[model samples]
Target chain A: MNGPIIDITDLSKFYGKARGIEHINLEIGEGEIFGFIGPNGAGKSTTIRILMNMIFPTGGSARIMGMDVIRDTKKIKTQVGYIPSDASAYSSMDVHEFLSYCIRFYQIQNGEQRISDLSELFELDLNRQIADLSLGNRKKVSIVQSLLHNPKLLILDEPTTGLDPLMQSVFFDLLRSENKNGMTIFFSSHILSEVQMLCKRVAIIKEGKIIQLEDIDNMRKKQLKKVSVELADHVNIKSFSIHGIENVITGPGNMLSFMYSGNINDLVGFLSGKEIINLMIEEPSLDEIFLHYYRS
Target chain B: MNKNLFLKEIRRNSVSLMIWMIVITLLIVVTMSFYRTFLENQSKIVGMLSLIPKGALQFKGISNFNDLMSVLGFYAANNVIYMMVLGSIFSIVLSSNILLKEEYDKTAEYLLTRPVTRSEIFISKLAVLSINVFILNLVTALAGFICMELVMKTPFSIGAFLILSIYTLLLNILFGAIGLFLSTLIKRAKPITTFSIGLVLIFYFIYTLSKITEGAAKMGYLSPFRFASVDATNPAYTIDLWHLAYFIGISLFLTGLSYRLYKRKDIYT
Candidate 1:
């Protein structure tokens, strides 16, 4: 409540000789939609599991809600909800039974009403057996269960896996509304566009380490910009030299594009004499920004 | 312990426990039903049994033909396989899977993320396992008692019958402890049901082999089944304190060790 809602310091986890995550340090403040992006086996789940106290970290520590993750797991979990990547529920239980079981773990009034509201929003049938539901329907059940207790902080790992586009829209809208009501969300996913769409700040992890941490606005406006140009005549582009110009590519008809990180004034001054035919500079897609980081 | 988890688990295993109870009870009923007919032809059956090897008779736990003259002895000798071996099998299967099922079924994520401590989860499941084993033993033992009551030509020692039932329960509980201990040591999330059953069968074989072979008699000590005395026909039939310590001591030790292991176990699902 005083400092950051989620604080991780020098955390490391190793699976025997293999690395799970190493020397990872991160802090996420209260009431923020923090994105954790990483490819498969990139230790996104490992960090989240340690935060949720599902697995113990081999070194360092993590704290949530200003308490140690391991020592205060039960207390911390009282206000923390999680939606795991896999949508596997107890196949023996129907939708209502599974959700009721989940909500009963927490001491909350109006649990049945909460379940009903969430199920209705997701269009989930409460009587259908989990084993009989499709993967997407199972995801809807998972989402409904996580929200039933009104946890202060929600951690979702690839939560949109089997969701249809319509359902995803509804889910995002719900998340937006929840965040506005003071819930901190740690959204972990490999999809950059989704992270870009929902998160104000993001940490990109690669190969068991954090590669980039930045605000979405600063990452786009304050730094990198995608610039492409066409000239009337082909020229030796190798002759051009400017700072922060990277990943340059050439196309037919003297078309060229590259990421520009230098001052816009300098870029324009350098190109003012050339490229008289056409010029365009715009914010890069999250994919291009990620490519820039990966390459760098 | 978490009461919600305990009740849910009990409900989940109810069907399996009931089926095991019925199967073992049915075996006892059918075996006891043959008691009266066997008594009518005692002399002929005794002569027929004389042709069988002494080792084979001992394997069925019938060291003396006169023991079969009593209904309790007949029931103990014939139903040892169903009550002790099969019951132990059931106990092990249930205990082994009770905790591991959450992982293999991929439901552990939901369970562990709840506002419950690992100890509460472990103890809740342990309570369910203990209660289920106790119920199974109680039902089958009562069935044995009732069958003896129905078929008895003369009243047998109630003390001896009670001792046999306690020994069977102790044996089943010990297997349950072993199952719990082994499950915590598994590194991956997969069903160990086959391996668990095979372990019971192999131990039973070692026990039976040791019973028949004089040289392998000492080897019987290696099997938990050896500590469970099935000699109900002996006039001095009683629960041996040493055997009692063996059952209780190993069970408590394994259960305690499993608790420690599970508390530190890195759950992967």
Candidate 2:
């Protein structure tokens, strides 16, 4: 409460010789929806697993609400909710039974009401067995269980894999309302659009390291740009080589496309002398930005 | 131990427990039902048994032809494999899967993320495992007792019967501990039911092999079954203090080791 809601300092996890996450430091303040974006196997789940104490860190420490994630895991979990990337629940149990079982872990008033409310919001069939539900429905069940406790911190790992667009919108609105009610969230996903839509601040991890950490708006407002040029005469990709240019590729018929993060003036001056049939420069989508980070 | 987890586990395993109880009880009853015919044709059966290889008979725990003269002896020789070996298979299978099922089922995310420590979860499941093993032993022992009472022409030694029952219980519990310890040693989430059952059978094979092979008698020490005295007709048959210590010591050691390993285990799903 006094400092950050979640504080991870130089946290590292290694599965023997294989790298998981290395020297990762992060601080998420209270009431913030913090996004952790990475491609598959980039250590998003590894970091979350360590924070949840489902797996141990090879070195360093992670704390939630100023309590050690390892030593104080039980206490930390009391106030934290987690939605795993995989939406596997007890298939033998119906939706109501599984949700009820989960809610009993926390000491809360009107747990039944909470279950009902959340179930209604997700349009989950209370009588449906988990195995009988579709993938999207199973995801809805996962989301409902995580919120039953009204935890101060909610840690979600790829929380929206199978939800429809409508459900995703409803889920996001619910998350906004919860954030307004003073819950800090750690949302991990490979999807950049969702992160861009919801998170205020984000950390971009690549190859087991945090490559970039910045405010969502600041990240977009940065000098990063998607540039494409069509030349009447064929231009060698070597000529387009400049600092901050990544993922350069030559398209059909004398066309070149790449991400350019260098100064705008320098990019324009470099292109001014070229016989340009057409030139296009615009802000890159978050996916493109993420690709740029990964390429860099 | 968390009461919620313990209760939930108990409820989850109740059906399996009941099925095991029924199967073992049926096994004991059906085996004991043949006692009357065995007694009636004693001389002819002895001649027939003598024609069979001595090592094969010993493998069935028949040390002597006279050991099957008494009803309880007949039960012990015929039913030890079912009650002890099969019961052990049941115990280990239950214990091994009780904790590991959550991992393979991918429900550990819900469990580990709850407001409970790994210690509490492990202890709770251990409690369920112990209770399950105890109930299986109690039910099967009672069924054996009833069958002996109903079928015996001569009364058997109740003391010897009780001692055999306790040995069976101890053996089953030791297997449960072994299963728990095995589950913790696994780095990934996968069902080891087949492997756990194989371990029990392999141990039984070792015990039987040692019994039949004169030169391999010393190898019985390696099998928990060797420590379980099942010869109910032996006048001096009692629960050996050394054997009791071996069962209790090994069980406690494995259980403690399992608990420690699980506490630090990186549970994956």
Candidate 3:
């Protein structure tokens, strides 16, 4: 409570010679909705697992609420709720049975009411067997279980894999409401839009390393966009040459497409006198952004 | 041990344990039902058994035809193999899967993330394995006792019968420990049921081979089955101290090793 809600210092995990994560340092303040974004197999789960004490780190250390993740895992888990990437529950158990099992782990008053409230919010049938639930429904169950105890810090790894758009909206809204009530969240996903929607700050991991860490607004404010221009007539590359234009490609119909990373106004001013049939500026996809980061 | 986890595990495994108990107790009853017939046709049966190779008879744990003269000997000869092999299979399969099944079922995320330490989880599961093994032994052995009482032409020594029951229980527990050790040694979360059953058979094969072949008598020492003496008809029969030490020592060593390995195991689901 006195410091960062979660602190990971120079953390590293190696599976023998293969890398899991290396010297990955992070600090998340209290009441923060922090995002950990990376492509699949990019050590996002590795870092979260270490924090949850599901696995140990090969080097360095991690702590939550000023207690070591390994040594104080039992105590830390009493206040931390985690939803794993895969929505695999005890399939033999019905929703009510499984949820009851999970809630029993925590000492709380009115646990049955808490289970019912969350299940209704997710539209989960209490009597439906987990094995019979759809992927989306199972994801809903996974989500509800993590919130049953109202943990102070929630760790979600790819929490929205199978939910429909409507349920996703409900889930995100619930997350926002939870954050408003001072529950710090560590949300991990490969989807840029979702991370960008809810997270205040994010750390982008690439190939088992923290490649980029910045505020979500700062990330967007970096102004990296795909610029595609179709000229009325053919123009030499020198005609529209400007700072921040990269990977320029000339195509049929005089289309010039490239990535732009600098001021949009400067580019607009430079294009004012040019005869252009169409000019487009769009946000790049997460992979494209990663490529840009790698190239930069 | 965490009582919540222990109780949950017990409930989860109850059906399988119940099935094992029923099957084994039934086997004992069915086999013991023939004790009166074996006595009624003793002369004719002796002639037929004499023609059969001694080693073939010994493989079923019958050291001599005369061993079957007593009711306890008949039980040891006819019914011990069912509990020995099937009970071992049950013990091993249960132990091997008790911890790793969470990983195989991809429910380790739920179990490992709980507000419980690894030690508590390990010990709780181990307790379940032990209790299941004990329950199976108690129920089947009690069934054998009742069946013997019903069919006995003359009363047999309860003391020797108790000793035989203890040996069988010890052997089953040793298999359970072996299974736990094997599960922990596995680097992946795949079911090792076939491998576990095969190990029990292989050990039985070694014990039988040592008994049947004069040259391979020393090979029996390599099998835990050799240490479980089944000669209930012999007046001098008792639980050997060295054999007891071997079973307890290996079981304790394997259980300890499993606990240590599981605490630091890099679980992947």
Q: What DockQ, between 0 and 1, does each candidate earn?
A: 0.76, 0.84, 0.78
The best-first sequence of candidates by TM-score reads 3, 2, 1
Candidate with maximal TM-score: 3
Instruction: Report residue A243 deviation for candidate 3 (angstroms).
Output: 3.3
What is the TM-score of candidate 3? 0.97
TM per candidate, chain B: 0.98, 0.97, 0.98
Superposition error at B175 for model 3 (Å): 1.1
Per-residue lDDT for A176-273 in model 3, tens only? 99999999999999998899999999999998899999999988777789989998888898765688888788988799988888789988888887
TM-score of chain B of 2: 0.97
Error of 1 at A228 (Å): 9.9
Q: What is the lDDT of residue B212 in candidate 1?
A: 79
**What fnat does each of the candidate structures reach?**
0.87, 0.91, 0.68
Instruction: State model 3's lDDT.
Output: 0.91
Off by over 4 Å in 2: A223-248, A260-291, A294-296, B59-61
For every model shown, the clashing-pair count is 0, 0, 0
Q: Give candidate 1's root-mean-square deviation (CA, Å).
A: 3.1
Q: What is the lDDT of residue A221 in candidate 1?
A: 59
Model 3 per-residue lDDT at A212: 92
Give one digit per residue, the lDDT tens place, for model 2 in B1-269.
99988988998999999999999999898999999998989999999999977876776657799888888889888886679998999999998999999999999999999999999999999999999999999989999999999998888899988898999999999999999999999999999999999999999888888887888889988999989987677788787899999999999999999999999999999
Q: Which 10 consecutive residues of model 1 chain B have the lowest summed lDDT?
A: B52-61
What are the lDDT scores of the predictions, listed in order? 0.91, 0.91, 0.91
- Residue pairs in steric clash, candidate 3? none
| Candidate 1 residue-wise lDDT at A174 | 99
Report RMSD (Å) for each prediction in the order shown.
3.1, 2.8, 1.7
